[model samples]
Target: MGSGSFSSVLKKPETTSFIILVLVMVGFTLANDRFLSPLNISNLLAFMPELGIIALGMTLLLTAGEFDLSVGAVFALTPVSTLLMVQNGGLSLELALVIAFAATFLVGALNGFLVTKVGISSFLVTLSMLLIVRGTTLVLTQGFPLNSWDGDNWLRTALAGSFYIGTVRIYASLIWFAALGLLALYVLNVAKVGNWITAIGSNRSAAVARGVPADKVKIWLFIATSMLAGLAGVISSLRIASASPVAGSQYELEVIAMVVVGGTALTGGRGTIIGTIIGVLMLRIIRNGIVLVGVPGLAFNIFVGVIILAMLVLHARFNKSSERK
Candidate 1:
């Protein structure tokens, strides 16, 4: 490929994402006049931290050429674990949070182990994990929401509650999301581990030959993804002041979609935290716009499906053009 072709291939992802973002914003704004308002933007920002956190991990995982279908279950299970610890075990909120995060990390480690050591596809392993974790949540909750935790105030105030800046109320998770985004950007763009991650995602065998410790990288990605999911779950529970078994149902799809739509290649080796952030914002805004326009919630899924398909088609076209050159 000539220099022009090489540069075009490199620029395609960013260009496509930018186009999609503009279209989403314009379409939604046209659908609902309030979609571009500060309040609606703020609400969309609130939606971002949870999915954004997960997508950060998911982006890493995807860049490493793996998927974690179990994230939704882990997300749901984290809050369940915290609630169980606080309600029946009488554990302090801090302790419960620690235990919950530890459990998620373990789940992630197991996922990495199964995929790398046992040679199982991440899809199968994480799907099985999804069922297992969801079942465990059901068993623990006995199919009921646990509203009995007594330490809601501290937990709520620390992570989920709104922080006021003059007349504006910002969700605390937003700060966490921004911090995580910057951290992820630094890791993926500047850190040694980030280079290893991208190398492994690009070619596992090549990365291994270069002493990248591919398995360890995969394992760490799994742990990171799960830990973020766990944190999101806990913060979400604190925000709501209760834990429900179904609290994060289908979250994996949403997070994965956000990452993929943001220009992360499922086949691996190319993605950006910034692009994923924009993708999350686009999805959240669309969802919020749907409600504002009186569209049924069910229709939001259709919209997401359409967006994902469009992104995939664009990705494929970009690759084909590059290959042709």
Candidate 2:
């Protein structure tokens, strides 16, 4: 039993993700000597946080057997709304941010209400929301980029600027990514809500019968997911000094792919934020590596698609084998 338990632990998704990450790192390093250079590393880390932040939220939602396809829409919408408030509405930047977030929270609440109270399927509801939010963003921005951000603003610097650590530069977004990732890790592994999430995913009816407020818990998760996406959007817009109406287009697919690649079950009931981090890193490195090796940017998606398919197949097989044992 002791050996069996050890083996089971070793077979976990986090372990697999870690091993894959290491292997990919080694492969990339061998392919390009510049892969480990300080500039490349810094850039890679910098690029990860936006998607990483969104992926963290997706991890929680998926673990609870819920989906939020509208995250990308929320992401695009938040920055657009913030910029509009600042540029057209003549509001203070900070106040604009506050209002943007409040709006996103309402959007999340609507998603939660429709799914939890109205009995709409999360997938369908969020999909419709994705279209609605994206459409609103396009109509508001008139399909143009909003470039009214002040780079000198303290808030902008704190949210998207770079800091130096000796000779290496680190992005503030990366700091946010690490801080949020650790916080998510703690919440998913140590908090009582984590148990509730898993219970609801595993057996919603059973969990409800056991006195868990399944609807409330799920609604809260939906809200948290949208808020995270909103924050990511703001950070991204600030980083670029612009908010494009088309920003975060197809991000829903990418975020879901990241969560699924991290070994979170598509049907939910099992996941780890730490594993998702590994998954994020692995995919990011692969994408970066492909570009470094002279692959066309358009081909990047093809590789990502192939990798996700392979991982899913392997993950399913592993589960089947474990069950047989």
Error of 2 at 31 (Å): 1.0
- Each model's C-alpha lDDT? 0.85, 0.88
1-325: candidate 2 lDDT, tens digit per residue: 9999899887887777787779888988898999998889888888799999999989988988998999999999999999999989998889999999999998899998999999999999999999999999999998888865774678888889898886568889998999999998888889898888988987899999999999999999899999999999999999888898888988888888888888888798988898788888888888888888777888878987887888888778777877753
Error of 2 at 255 (Å): 0.8
Considering only N, C-alpha and C atoms within 3 Å, which residue pairs clash in candidate 2? none
Cα lDDT tens digits for candidate 1, 53-147: 99999999999999999988888899899879878898887888788888898999999999999999999999999999999999999989997
Minimum summed lDDT over a 10-residue window in model 1 is located at: 148-157
Measured with C-alpha atoms, the lDDT of residue 136 in candidate 1 is 92
